[model samples]
Target: MKKTLLALLCAFITSAASAQSVSTVVHPEWSKNAAIYEANIRQYSPEGSFKKFEEYLPELKKMGVGVIWIMPINPIGKVNRKGTLGSYYAVADYTAVNPEFGTPEDFHHLVNAIHAQGMKVIIDWVANHTAWDHPWAKTHPEYYIHDAKGNFVPPVPDWADVIKLDYGNAQLRSEMINALKYWISNYDLDGFRCDVAAMVPTDFWNDARTQLDQIKPVFMLAEATERDLQEHAFDMTYGWQFKDVWGDIAKGKKNAADLVAYLHGEEAGYNPNSYRMLHTSNHDLNSWEGTEFDRLGDAVETFLVLSNTLKGMPLLYQGQEAGNTKALDFFERDPIIWKDHPYRALYTKLFHLKQTNHALWNGLAGGQPQLIKTADDDHIFAFSRSKDNDQIIGIFNLSDKARKFSSNDPILQGSFTDPLTGQSGQSASAPIELKAWEYRLLVK
Candidate 1:
């Protein structure tokens, strides 16, 4: 009887532990079919103010953007600031809005306006570090890491504008959590996009998430790609690997098989419910690297389609829709040159399909990509994701040369129409011919 009771107790303990591990965080319902847009408020318009940026909310909503991830709006550090206008990541204050952007009241109205448009807003949070001038350096010196000489140090050598924050201090953790809570409580923000999230202790984020959720369900996006971050803290992480592989394919180094392998690897590595943010270009990529047009060449639209339909949430950076060729200045006000570009229409079609089609929904709410066998698997990539009555089939010609391919996969047999072009009557009976850097997104 003693032996049996001991065995039962151990099993019960193990089961409880498993349940606790799996139930760390619950995602917000609105995020399931949402496509996130990174709004560079400072560079969004000529004025680069909240009032100016707010004028385009209707256009964004119509463009099918579900969530708006605003870049840092806090006052930038001036002591060791970079360029005339310092980097957005070098934050001096956590709670106050940057006067350059607008008054705190203006920001409040902007957030309310975004919510009113049936969309969500999240602010970029630089948790790992702060500007050298941040008050914490004087009042709460213990909150930061110190050098042997007792001077403050930057997290990275090149990041001289900011000082590294130390999560080892319990008081610092509590204070940071309080600051995070302040935004949600006051502004009613949907969530935060934590910058360099992995640099901060995972336990700190876990605690933060728990406390934030107590206020309201929030969507957390981590800039890092660490898988463990998703298990507890973040709802989504950057799909840097996918972006790299896509770039390689465009450069003629990696092919379709390599792309498929990366997708398979992602499936095995991340939980089905974990959201990966896939994008062709972002603030960093566009500024540091070249524009998507420069890197992907003519294949920019082709990769954009894959990023939208593949098993993850899609991210659209500001200016991408306008086919903005110039990499806007990161530290200065370089407004996007908006024009009636064709990419805008393409993005609208893809984003709307993602919202309506259950197959392309984000995380576990959506179906997984099943590879559809094609004759030219090397140069052509084809796959289908279906949920209930909704289905989307994506076929891409990854090479610079046109390719002809045929697929006998049962999923490809049904009649389908191209969502972007509205052309119908495409079927698996005839071979498909695609031009170089062209893609066909068929929906049924």
Candidate 2:
């Protein structure tokens, strides 16, 4: 009996390993050193048409962006809508383009334009729920969850514009997966950024990912941070905790020591190959919470450096380059004001650095960061990453007062060039002086 049980366990382990191998092989090769940018279609411009957005592709490409994550392009439901322009998450038709955005052909052209500029396009997909007016709610009520009175209900009380999808029904799962395939077959989309991904069944995502790859090797990004999602479903998960840490530091609630502790915990907890999408601001944080300016305060630029140089893929939200100052309205037509800004140069330089610096690349493609001992460990954060001979040392003063930090760590004492300033020099062995919230990246 013991031998029989052991044999069964061995068989199960082998089967699981094979399944993981298949999923691991499906990651697109192009994503190895990629950085993602969130494109808010509704507020990309005053017009918000695909045709107009296509014109901005070249500039984005110039900024060294590799992936363009377009917000939900599906038509928004009108039933119990919230504002003059409803929320983009209330998806009415999975296969149809929002008339407010443009015709299907226009989106196709935009995708083509994005590809022409050597950037990949990923559409925001809300598979957990749909707008109240979605046909499935009326024609196939069994595909939705119902209240005690047998009346269809929203997933949560706050999200009144949409209704929850019932993945328990086999037919509903098949239909949702088919809708996913429709985008790949019709528009040749690269992949999806699943909204509220953790709320859906993991099995559904695993199945959907399997089918999606059959059409094309797609890159999937989950809005959630569950490590299990990386087993076979998503290439990247949101770095929410990291963002929270940044906010805490900005508010003087945490310091460099806290960040070092957090990094150690993350390294020990998550799978080494799992890619975390790091960012200072995203759509949800910008709309629901506040702009980076409001939350990050004086530490905004300092946090941006950490987001881009850290061991993960970084995200650039729409209007962030222009230093977007306001929280974009969630349910209304609010356009981003564009202008020449230093933030643009900062991001462009960092994006370029991310591409060339193997030590800063994503996932297993890059080297893991090793913390370097400094003069002030509590208020000064310092780390070094090296892949082969390529090396980068980053030091940031995470305090409200100017400070001098000295470190004898050989990994940091070397010849280096400033990617930001184009200055070249050797370390003077003197204490490094820095202003509050200042950072220095020394690359060799």
Candidate 3:
């Protein structure tokens, strides 16, 4: 009987350990309260050089930015390349910097400058495919996926300039991992924003995360929204559904009720410890879809506030603060016209609030959002978050018309200050009015 019991106990222990998720994996200590800024080197300045970008580091740091995610720096394949300079995603070599951006030494200097400014850096990685002329096509023909005719093929019909990689090939997986490690070993990069991470196998990402952690705890951001990816391989995933819902609201097709439902659905579906990246604009959205102003109209800042204060890590894409109002030319040189804008100050204030308020921290480090009941739930969205002694309440008029609402929730009836307008006072169940597309963020 003792022998049988011992064996059963051992089996149970192994089962529990095996069930541990990638979400529980080790993360760098620095990421606890971090916010990410996506830097598109090409569109950031006219020169599109790393050295020129390095000059903007101090200003970004002053804005309370913590992590900088630079777009791909690898050389692009000339064969079958698209556009005037080729897509940055069509990587020709994994280990070298794009000469158009600058030399490898110049990149190193830029990374050092970012570090010197007390910020972390992550590079965009395109592991799902490579440029058609990538040496692997000739040196390791077996490493790529083949069409029905047994010829190398692109992953999708539209991505003709790049060919897909076959993760099924063990050697290819090994080589891909080696290339990932090479960047960390050589450039001292903090982590990666994996492009189309869902196209690659989850096991490969799990293994890569494990191996990369052996060198140093790394932050991984997946461009996809697979929950399993966050379980062990990624620290964060794209909040695609959130963006979709917001877009619908901006278009007057959805309302605050829909947002509340989404919040509940997200809470029930995603792991409590998983971080979601919230953003109003990104490379794909700004270049392919449309700029936030074009999509959201006069409600642009309203949506931006929702992204920042929501229960996730906020993402500020390149030139978003300056309100780059046009869809940038994806395949040609289109530089952002930098100027002093209210959006800059807005982000600076919101980012500082995110860093200091434990109630607003990322993932498990922060508070769970408690939806505050209010009259006119269809137009007025209200919620509060509390962690320890810190508390934050956010109320927004998501509709195009002005909204009037009354809230009797005890959590909101107290002395509070509005971070945006600097108004402070005790609250009651009295009716409150908000202008069209206006929001209030109260803190105690």
lDDT of 1 by residue, 153-179 (tens): 999999999999999999999999999
The lDDT for every candidate, in the order shown, is 0.90, 0.88, 0.88
Q: Compared to the true structure, candidate 1 yields what TM-score?
A: 0.94
Compared with the true structure, what per-residue lDDT tens digits does model 2 show for residues 268-347?
A: 45566778899999999999899999999999999999999888899999999999998999888899999998999999
Question: Candidates sorted by lDDT, descending order?
Answer: 1, 3, 2
| Quality of model 2 by C-alpha lDDT | 0.88
- Name the top lDDT candidate: 1
lDDT winner, 1 or 2: 1
Each candidate: how many clashes?
Answer: 0, 0, 4
**Lowest summed lDDT over 10 consecutive residues: which window, candidate 2?**
17-26
Per-prediction TM-score:
0.94, 0.93, 0.94
lDDT of 1: 0.90
**Residue 381, model 1, lDDT:** 95
lDDT of 1 at 267: 40
